[model samples]
Target: MQLVFEVCEVADGNPVSTVRKVFDGVGGVIGRGSGCDWVIHDPSRLLSSHHGLVGCREGRYFLTDISSNGIGMAGSCERLRKGQARLIEDGDVFELGALSIRARLMEPVQPFGEQPVITGVPIPDDAFLALDPLQALDLEHQRQSTSDELEALSAGVGEPGAWADRHAADREQVAMPRRVEPANELPRVDSGALASPSDDVFWMEFAAALGLDLGKLDHVARKALAIKVARLFRLEVERLQHNRAYEEQVRLISTLHSDYPG
Candidate 1:
């Protein structure tokens, strides 16, 4: 079975270098000798290593404080104390300073009707038979006694006392909600002053009846129309000025010509 492992931090946007150093340390432990095929280490890029060798082994995966600071796996069942060998299982999370690495166990597939055989592995004869039942029972009794004591301590805690009530009252007296004034609304514009619907409707209907071909109207035509409109407006203003000047000149010339008549 190929295992999948991921390394991330509690804080977002951690540097790639920190992630790499973690993989390097993990690689050193499981990447030696024949285990090279079962371990991978790279931190520069994600998906850097392929195959099933990027994670740590179950029994062999151990944590150490090689870093200048220290590393810890928060919320772990085994309680990974400083420089301790905490056995890693599938879905186990370990924190190395800010870095957090999660392990996922992959299930191994077996062929049908094939009874699995355990061979050549170190096995001690009478390993299970060597247990002392009386000693085991004593340890179990001690565990139960400890659990009962914890429950009793938890049940004793109840509502706050007089001191807590006084503190709460003091805190309430110090703070109060401020008043929020109403905001001034903007004055509305008069709808009657705006252009009427009839004005727009007439122009729209006239434009529709003309069947204006928008595609046929290119940049040149638009430019030409704009120039013509500007020129016409300028000519009308010029014509008014010219008429006024001509009227003044004619009045003066008539007066002069009349005065000098032979």
Candidate 2:
């Protein structure tokens, strides 16, 4: 049976749930013990070391609760015990101490939100391809096709002319980076000054401004995406905390621009 562990509750300092596959097979264990196939992470000290076991027999999924504390199952009045192997089906939610994960046969359902909570980013449908590194950075960065690069791929390659042109183009891009509007300049950092955009403290501040608790996020990539999305929200908001947040956002945008430049 396919199952996913959706974090219904997070303990203090717990990172947010990462999009990951915990188990593929039918048999597994859910406990605090290291030997268990799926180690239970309980911050409340509620679950015992050997808590529960999951297995499949006759194409039916079942869970055996062995902990001193009862294991709660959805739609069941009474909890399952060691002797009683509770039948698990799709939409089944299992509770082990403070953490409860919903089990399903497919991908975990996205949480409810007015704006789509984007967990995955699809490739651009424009089908834009990059032939060079600088061209990849800014698609609009106009350039003429080099003859040597073409010849190199086809036959004995072009002369030293091709290599020289490519090297020159790279230098030009660095010398004069195209900037956009007011946020063109990257946030400046000074010695012993306040936290800069590149510093970890800035991101922490950014998260706080956006109400993003880093401890609630588990995956690094998801944490990065959260920051990106939060900045996108910051760009649109007219007021924050009953006051104009525009000034703070300009500084925030400076940092954001440093990370993502056109």
Instruction: Give the best candidate by TM-score.
Output: 2
Poorest lDDT segment (10 consecutive residues) of candidate 1 = 46-55
> What lDDT is reached at residue 199 by model 2?
57
lDDT of 2 by residue, 1-262 (tens): 4566566654354643342235443455566655555665565668665576665554455677767576886556767766467777777777666666676665434467755665775644333332356655443232235365654564422213445455566667775566756957788764435534575665567544433334333345435555545553453242233245666788899999999999
What is candidate 1's lDDT per residue for 130-231, written digit by digit as tens?
346885576557557767777566532322344345456777788677898967988776543364687456434532332222233344453454464355
Q: Model 2: C-alpha RMSD to truth?
A: 24.8
> On a 0 to 1 TM-score scale, where does candidate 2 land against the true structure?
0.36
